[model samples]
Target: MSEPWTLHPDRALPADPTVRGIAREVYAATRDLSIVSMHGHVPVEWFAQDSSFGDPAQLFVVPDHYLTRMLVSQGETLPRLGVGSTETEAVEQDPREIWRRFCAGWQHFRGTPTRYWLEHAFVEIFGVTQRPSAATADAIYDQVAARIESPEFRPRALLDTFRIEVIATTDPAWASLEDHTRLAKDGYGDRVLPTFRPDPLLHVDRTTWREEIDLLGRAADVEIGSYETYLAALRVQRQRFVEAGARATDHGHLAADTTPLDDLEARRVFDAALAGAVTAAEAEAFSGHMLFQMAAMSTEDGLVMQLHPGVLRNHATAPFAAFGPDKGYDIPVVTEFTRSLRPILDAFGHHPAFRMIAFTVDEDVYSRELAPLAGVYPALRLGAPWWFLDAPDAMRRFRESATETAGFSNMSGFVDDTRAFCSIPARHDLARRVDAGYLARLVAEHRLDLDEATETAVDLAYRLPLAAYPAPR
Candidate 1:
């Protein structure tokens, strides 16, 4: 029988004798550093309730799009994996069946980051000694389920176990933030913070735009009559987020365009959108204009702006119609940052109070446009490899591509951008190991001293995230 699955001590390190030795030394310094997840999609309710994850399938299979998407590609249906059922499809109700399907397809995740993260979580978090397979699925589930029932596996308790110094949850602009308020009173306000995400509000062409606008108006306690009042209401909501310990604003638009329209044009579009008569071109223009407006707000409010563009969200209409968004149908397109972001960069690139981190699913832009732009812009730092590019080889390629021009300081370190709470530490661990391997290459080439590489590794893992997204004052 094959040996039980276990994480290798030097899993992601270089294989060359001298470089591998150097990587081991670099990894040691950052192996246990406190995680600073400045940006992610982890639900606030998890920490608010301090609840136990229901079971292995619920925790690992149901909510993780990364896991679900891979399974769907292999001809597995969504309902079988416990994804929400629709009228046309009946969802899987038995947790054991979902776990069995996941284990049977474990080989699909081979050579993927999901596999690395799962292995890490199994070996490190749950102390699972056996590999996931059809034969071992039930046994491993029993082992994990037994441990999860313990008090130590509770959401709040796992924060200490995961060594999460600070984690930020993405919140809609219209969110009440009552849970955040409760968390603040419970003394976890700073540890678990909120990030303002205004995507729905900014995209006027969405079918639910007017309803979202009303929700925003109610949340901010502002009566919206015109575009000016709408902006004011948004400002009020941003201030609310700030007071709730938010340090950053997250924007995931399809493009990086930041061109602002004239006052009259903006007013016209707002009125048209309110009346349900706005054109697609006008809606697109307004969203780009709002990005410029958001950059202005960031300058005034001291909230860092995180822009990750170039995703064509919900590429498959059938699944999207059935399951809704974030079911892993987002596809990357070629994005031109140099021309598209000039308006915002020219406006706030040198501003003292403004800060922005640019992330891209388009890795082709890393060396060509993003690195050069980030190298000189005082307000901008190129974000770490995001979404599809967050894998090990992709991360190594990111360092190779972005470091030449942007250097280490101009990079946003590692932002896991995950929604899976239990996978947080594993995701961060992968990034650190990848960075150590990259820095070891630099040290091996004599471009950086061993001491410099070691210190740089720590900064990438810890200091840079804090500096880029400072705690809200």
Candidate 2:
């Protein structure tokens, strides 16, 4: 209100000057800290291909489910957000128009995490001094569009500008890690590495299951026709990810269940699934068994495990078939982590080498399930808020709920699981501001000293993620 487009005084904190001052100091200390992104859904090809980004919408809106979900919530629809529909010809295929629609519905994101992120993007990246709305859409768009074309906004340059020390990209078992190889050879060092995500191989319900399984068999030189060989192939792939500088494996399951089964029963289930003679329940059970097996392997190899459950992925089968997965249709469901993860915990929860990070869409589990688990288990660490829960509000909720039990040390810090390279800075900046705000409150309430609060902020922003999911030396 005071200026054409000034950032909110408390954009990342409460609107109290005293608290804001302390937050600013805490944020400053951690602003330039090394970014260690331990998890994300980014395609490995971007780094592998080492290509420049295309356009504004393609780089930002098209790939981000957050933007599309909000647009759809306001009734703009995904097709208008560049989501390809069955009858793609009849859709509003114009990016400019889509951008305008996005600009018009900007109010929907107000007071939400998205708005804070977008405003940081507008101000810090594009040098925009105005909010995104009908009055300034074209101007805002053009400014950002022009800057992205400049040499400074190039991917590698942006990576440097953003102070990114290390970034992990999720790769399926089949990936060759050629880009990661290139990055290291090009003296990029440990800046960009691969994270092994075995979801495609784990979820037997996927249509590409057989093909991926076959590919895994060939990659591992094993007869994956049997369940024994399938597990062997996974071990081989784990080694490959480790060699490529990965110290973590990510599993996105329907639930956190881990059922440890013996040879005969496991073989029977796998054979049934492989031969298409299995029921849905059998496949789920087999998947659960494999989770424990994976953890056992993790104990052997020292690869940290991250389980992000409670997403009913692509619930609308028709939309998934037409538009592909992660198109803003997936919704969070209530999950039971304590009951689901019991079998695995019973087996390897005491193992010194096995480290597991718990991520949940079910916020209710934070106090009831996550905290108590992380509090007691030396092998377990609370994963940073992920997927639908990675916003400022969600981060705040997590800190308030989990800190009492898990504390700052028991949790991994921020992870910029993003594909839009420009958004990297914007996202991390928002996290720092929010963390600073949180710390400032503790200081204001006389619950913490400024020095200790500042130290915790730095750890939350930098050191914790590094220690939680360190890349192999």
Candidate 3:
């Protein structure tokens, strides 16, 4: 028989009895709060059309880089897991086989956050009572498949079930946002919003930059013949996004540098890049300058600027060439935020209209760099432990490191930056549990009172995200 799978009510709480009790109280106080997903990659079309998801493998294994990357590390090829290949080649075409492969490698997820999230979904969302393994994979897949076929398991139905008050979907600068508009017309405007992501347009070194620039110009109905025109086109796009109900702009760059260049120098670099003659160093410099320009735009338009830097994307060329980006080869490197952000922060750190949230995968800079910066700058806030550091211990370390300096208010709150829609509730629940445990220890030590911890828990789970990324006025 397969081992029974169950979720303990007090899972993720402190091991000590007294602290555990305190944590339970704290968690219970805020466990049912509505989610405010300020930044994510979930396609808006899913919710707009209220689409029914595919089989278990399609929902769980195929799209999630978190699972695919781990399986890849264990000698399992991506193609075997239903991941599409870059070259013209056949891959595992059966969803059932992909599900079986995932189950067979379930042991590899032991002691990882991926295991916790998956189990939470299995027990709480799908009502699966048997542990996933090669022996029970078929049974569990059938059960999940049946559950998802029901109308109640549709994407819109699941959104309501997940208690998601609002979610922001990342869109390219040139996106029409037709789905977002449709949702708005359907009276779901208050619930779903768009986030502008201009990475492809900003990174001149990429081969797709020229195409993206043309796309942007066409989207904005502007002719971009100079650097000034390009900036104007970007401004127009931001306005379009704001009109479409976007409250934030998201940037994922290789570095956090935001130094501005003189108009002449910037124009010169733009011309070289436009001609496809720019060097790597010139591209890096131009990208850094664009960060400053983005901040300037945010100051004028009131869109929250979210910067997540230091990710070396597509570290391995073979897989990236065969597959596409976000195949889980992105790795974090040491990032220096303090000096790099000085130019932009110095320019608009105190501007009332400017709001910036800094996210980093480099934990070494949390207390030493991010907290200190956010603690002082009125416009700057620290984003939650993100991407690679969204695990249990890493989150605890973030709170311990940041709270003493920046306090709870400086936090942008828990953002479920995931493409896996069903995993949203599980990810947020884990964050709440971790925060409750952290606060419980503080209350036990008399650093905070129980009532205060309860209120803080609610804010961390719900309120802060709204405050950080408020609906655009």
Pairs of colliding residues, candidate 3? 86-322
Q: Which lDDT tens digits does candidate 3 get at residues 55-124?
A: 9999999999999999999998889999986465568999999999999999999988899899999999
Q: Per-candidate TM vs. native?
A: 0.99, 0.94, 0.98
lDDT against true structure, model 2: 0.80
lDDT of each: 0.92, 0.80, 0.93
Tell me model 3's lDDT, rounded to 2 decimals. 0.93
TM-score for candidate 1, residues paired by index = 0.99
Backbone collisions counted per model:
0, 0, 1
Give the lowest summed-lDDT range of ten residues in model 1: 1-10
User: What is the clash count of model 2?
Assistant: 0
Off by over 4 Å in 2: 1-3, 88-93
Model 2 Cα lDDT, one tens digit per residue, 393-413: 888888899998988888878
Q: Tell me the spans in candidate 1 whose CA falls farther than 4 Å from its real position.
A: none
Selected candidate, larger TM-score, 1 vs 2 = 1
Model 1 has how many clashing residue pairs? 0
